[model samples]
Target: GESVGLHLPTLSVQEGDNSIINCAYSNSASDYFIWYKQESGKGPQFIIDIRSNMDKRQGQRVTVLLNKTVKHLSLQIAATQPGDSAVYFCAETRGAGNMLTFGGGTRLMVKP
Candidate 1:
């Protein structure tokens, strides 16, 4: 079965450096993609998102890039901070009433 997934289980980065997290989705029909950040004891929070029609989207300190041809997606964080440390997951939705398929999360660790 096709699924949306991440390429890495974890990532470690310096507090002041940039970070890139990658994801891959097998369903070409998925029209919406979202990146979420989950803190240790909290619910997942929305970080950024991109539609299939767009290749990239940017937020305050984050950017999401989509490559439909390769079914690849990535999130880029600028100047990663300790507060930015969390488990990040990618989710995809198709034709939906808010139904989403989530990928395995990638734990991001920011070293001070």
Candidate 2:
């Protein structure tokens, strides 16, 4: 995304490697975690999700780690590419509706 209200702008990353983005949540009741990727000027697409009961989840070249102990979360991307470049956001939901609480968001710059 094009940066939050007044927080830090973004971080730059190179292609063909891994990238990790961090996020923190306020609610302790949150039990579900999801990661989303948003290309420029588009809605965020679901990436992967993990339940509070689980600590780790993996997907195609991607991994989501949840730390309920600290109310922290992270997303990891492997062999990143230009197509993989975008703004990534982490979300947490308490229950139904799949409602998501987004983080500060970060832009992934894949060097060609």
lDDT of 1 by residue, 1-112 (tens): 9799999999999998999999999999999999999999999999998999999999998999999999999999999999999999999988748689999999999999
Cα error, candidate 2, residue 95 (Å)? 3.3
The sequence of per-residue lDDT tens digits that candidate 2 reaches over residues 1-112 is 2211213347677788788877777687888878889998999999999998999999999999888797778888998889988888887776578666777678888887
**Model 2: residues with Cα > 4 Å off, grouped in runs:** 1-9
TM-score of each: 0.97, 0.86
Clashing pairs in 1: none
RMSD of 1: 0.7
Instruction: Look at candidate 1 and tell me the lDDT of residue 104.
Output: 98
Task: Tell me how candidate 1 scores on lDDT.
Answer: 0.96
- After the best TM-score superposition of candidate 1, give how far the Cα of residue 76 lies from its true spot, in angstroms: 0.2
lDDT of 2: 0.79
